[model samples]
Target: STQNANETQAVVASVLGLSANKIACKVKRLGGGFGGKESRTIPLACITSIASYHTKRPVRCMLDRNEDMAISGQRNPFMGKWKVGLDENNKLVALDTELYLNAGWSSDLSVAVMERALGHIDNVYYIPNVRAVGRCCRTNIHSNTAFRGFGGPQANVIAETYMTEIAERIGMTQEQFREMNFYKEGQTTHFDQELKDWHLPKGYFQLKEKSNFDARKAAIEEFNKQSKWRKRGISLIPTKYGISFTALHLNQAGAMIHIYHDGSVLLSHGGVEMGQGLHTKMIQVCAEGLQIPLDMIHIVETSTDKVANASPTAASASSDMNGMAVKNACDQINERLEPYRAKGLPWKEIVHHAYFDRVNLSANGFYKVPDLGYKWGENKGQLFFYFTMGAAVSEVEVDLLTGSHTVIRSDVNMDLGRSINPSIDIGQIEGAFIQGMGWSTTEESLYFPNGRLFTQGPGNYKIPGFQCIPQEFNISFFEDVTHESVKTVYKSKGVGEPPLFLGTSVYFAIRNALWYARQE
Candidate 1:
């Protein structure tokens, strides 16, 4: 495990016949990237830059299907054995897991990924005597990189699978088992982090009620009991996603806000958009902060030259960090306008008056969460932030003889911590859930013997189709849950990666359906 990112840069330079200084790499958004855009992109970019520099021409190289799949990284495939011990009421007591990650070639982000896996090994449950050890097994395949959920979904899947197995062993339904073990208020997790206001179980229970989880489970069981060729299954899945970058220092964020005389706003931050609507959400944040129309705010492209000394945009912390920074800037302007507001003028008029006063209407705000004490030798984990949970239930029908399955209906209830735009947030949740479903069920990657990927392009690989999406898709947010925002307009957490694990429920539902098929 070599420390520092520059080492990776140096290795890329040596392989590609370029000096490290000449690399001039730029970070940007990648559409539909499966963790391949992280450290794994350095080698390809270095090669391209070297080709361009030596030839003194516009040399362009792009990977075709096989080459791209071989060269590009993947979401690490993990094999873990978990034994969860629950008490009489299904309260989680202890958990032990052995995690083996297929960290192909050079370790890359494997250490961080595996550590994260171990860190979140218990998912949302409060389990004692939790023992999780991870080994990054070096293989001759392409290296794995960070996906949307990072290693969180993988680790959580293991825990949730344990939930399913335990439920089966105890002759209980999956929902009952999950509800019994869900994180309760004032409980300390395996990492010794005491959940100050943990509401995962409350949120999950609300979701269960809304999604008719009990009704669905009963129906599925009855259907499976009657059918010989087909079966049904349901699951209540929850996600307790930690919001900060695990590497402590990378958790800070900076933002620039410029408000013009006409009351228009220009916003710049480190986070990039990969069609996930990060930009749209940022605009909403700025608008809410300034108490102005959403149209008044404009988001600019993220650039190092503009927002200098910025952290890499990952970990679902962009909104939490940058949105707070923008709010800080807005507060500054609002403070200056307060005098005019004291004159009994409307806020807009106050803003207009302040603008004409030749107000120095530009600001840069920074945010680093305070009192987050993390020491290397402490052997303890205290969160700079806590996780928000969501529950998803998928009902699936499997054709036993054909070995095929269809998702007949799906229901989702997410606690996204005070959604700014309920409609937009729902769409995001639905999209991520669908994408994750594809990852588990439809999308599969292929690699050559020499560690090159074969399924590289859209032509070769297949994701989910419209037909595959459940017809009876239903979603709702938990009510009365305020965005406990300490720094921003509303205390809203990132809604990006958490819902991706909803696919786990879908996959397990399929598994349960298939189990019923096996009995038949």
Candidate 2:
């Protein structure tokens, strides 16, 4: 729904004659779009629509992997240069960064992606004086599109690289270097958004203790001193990902619910089910809102005809906005049924009476999350409603002879406030983390000098399969946590994209092992 509305606009413009009012774009739920489908889905639709209009028949366009690679884009490749001032103690004093993102063939979402990159280059650290400039550099290759973490991972990697290099310079562990500079309570981000509900420390310490990072670091040092061929390394990382879109208008969602005479419910929301369990959690939120059993509520696929001008299901804030919309719809119906309940009637009987008594059985609900803006000129505003805190420690063994590494173990700690559905949230965390791990570790993009991608298919490219996953993958959630800043449904935080950036722990761990191997 987020980009579907835009697709309609694109189609209308591409047709070169259709007025906006003459066309209606009805969209159903999409599958697993981590920002890729948001912008890339436009080109195919517009091209096909034009063909359909000329031919007077429905047109279908399908591109195989090679063809798709030839047209579509991958994550924008980034290059940055920076000047940093560190005090004698190696604490960061100021950071000035100028980033250039390869926009590829054209400027698609590269500018917006650059904005997110600039915002995240700080990566939760408290730098008193920081300045940044980002430019989208055009190239001859296919236009780069969005991937899972948007541009957060690329920027965070930059921050973490500096953190590690400084740590080594000062003879301190990466954890110590990072923790010493964390944004404490009552502090503010570079954008002047006052930091609140700080959970990074809470998760970082617990993850370190559980992962036994210090002991493992010591042991790895000793092992590397003896083993020349195989070197081991361990790294711990913390991340703070803000929820909501860079654009404020994309922060809202709508839901429509119907209560039948039999007390059954039909739920429709503008959230696409990309296998992150948005539908399942919405059902849970709906059932809990109406105080009904889960089986009593049914959700239909998201369609534009059902919810107009819906926001795209990116930003990891889908559940936040859609859940609130579902809650609003259920609340209205509950108010209508309150009288029947006071008469000591069952749910079905209440619905029967409410229907006959002329009480509205169907309600359309809408919600827009607050704190959706920031002022660049003044460097002030609530940029994020709340933070999704996470920390991870990954240990790896690198083969010095061949540039291959294996993740021995990974421990992750997340503070999701109170998860709507623990299982679904856990599944999201796992899936996002794994996908992110692939991006930083096994997934590499190669291109020929002529601007054509060489790794166009799986035969030439590689992705992390199950065999590459950490042998001891441990995940722990922060218990009894509640967000007091703003009441997001059930006090739950965003889960979809936050964990994706945490997977960089594996990359850094591999680097650490390689650093040891180089010494030998």
Candidate 3:
């Protein structure tokens, strides 16, 4: 488990100036981080380690909620300027964007965040002549760090904003414009990654039919016309998120599996469980690989001693890489137990024999995502192992008098190839979309003149609650998912950070209602 995969490296190499092995960071659990703990949390540990080193004794340092909020990083606020060129048929011909990200006070992870933003500038569309320039501006506040979706959410907002403007400028419905401009199966992205197993439009159209979007759009229009101070709107938005680290070295993972004499198993992997069910998935992966019942395998804690030099649990690739490593470890154990099974021995008897035979009951496994990463300078290699694709149809009703709004309904369709657990995957889809919705709509951060955060706690700031959820929400998976793009773990795609951008549909739908209101 990791917030900073390099925390030990940072403290060892930089703070104490000691060997990497001199320090070990142990992670027991993370309730919820949302990228807040990715890199910015390094400073906390570094400072504490320094205090302990100098004092020659144990030291504990903790901050209250106010102190944490006042000093810690926030999401990078962005300002973007763009120009889009569309052909006579409204097909995207070219797009040029200048994105300025506020990297408050320190650089932190701003560069990597900006790169993900630049890579995502096209979102789910294909623009032939697209050029994106990103600037990480220095500001006078606590350094902004990774939030959920990293830089992709900011980029999606810019792309969708211009897309909505273009649709209205040409007197076309938002749904029709977005559908017509989607990338076909053979299209390659601006960054040169080929769109294999392209299912963005597949899920998009299916969601359209399942949600009855066409009829609802017309019905909303009639309702808006009859109402005086309230207007209704509907929109369809799609997401295509790359599912690996942009940094090549972070693409590897390690797992350690120990089979005891009693045939019970202890599995340790290089992934943090932050209320996301990562440990549960790894247990399943281990159980499947070992061909045993789920109850026989128990996942130990995530610690540096268990799996050294592990990657951060961010990037949504923890499962993709860690699950593979667990599988490899299980395979090693199975191979050792093969002879016993050939002799018609049961699992417990095989384990007992293997323990007595000294057949290496403990296995260390490692895996590196093959053919991964992109060169920022060349901009021509694969940025991801594969892409996680999904689409959403959201309908919003906005109050003209008070500027309040309600989400009438939302429909989401995703291409999660052979979901390891449909219940968990759907929960992730729901949680991520709601979090993204909060970012785009009600969740606003304020600042004082001297660079102090005004919205430090829930009292001043707002997050989505039960009342803000859609009145009707539907979720469906693409039945014809193919893993030809990249053979991920269990032929399943990453779901943690991809469905987040689909929440922008609510924002776009609200914009549509506001657009119609402006006409009056």
Each model's TM-score, in the order given?
0.88, 0.95, 0.97
Clashes of 1: 5
How well does model 2 score by local distance difference test?
0.83
| Residues 347-426 of candidate 1: C-alpha lDDT, one tens digit per residue | 56776888788777788877876545555346565654767678787888888788777888888887777667777788
lDDT of 1 at 98: 97
Question: For model 3, where is the 10-residue window of minimal lDDT?
Answer: 1-10
| Candidate numbers, best TM-score first, in rank order | 3, 2, 1
lDDT, each prediction: 0.74, 0.83, 0.87
The collision pairs in model 2 are 2-311, 2-312, 32-274
- Clash pairs, candidate 1, are 69-453, 70-452, 70-453, 483-491, 485-491
| Position 372, candidate 2: lDDT | 65
List the candidate 3 regions with Cα displacement exceeding 4 Å. Answer: 54-57
Candidate 1 lDDT (Cα, whole model)? 0.74
Alpha-carbon RMSD of each model: 4.0, 2.0, 1.6
Name the candidate that leads on TM-score.
Answer: 3
Local accuracy of candidate 2 as per-residue lDDT tens digits, 1-520: 3344545554556575776555556555554677777778777778777888889999877778887777778998888888778887767889999998999988888877887788788897899899988889988899998877778878888888888887887788777788888888778777777777777777788888888888888998999998989999898988888787877778888999998878899999887787788889999999898888999998887766677768877778889999999999988888888888899887888898888899999989999887567876677676777878889989999988888888899888999988888888888888888888888888888889999988887777787788888899988897555467757998888898889988889999998888887665
lDDT of 2 at 115: 76
Q: Which stretches of candidate 2 lie over 4 Å from their true place?
A: 1-6, 9-16, 19-31, 54-56
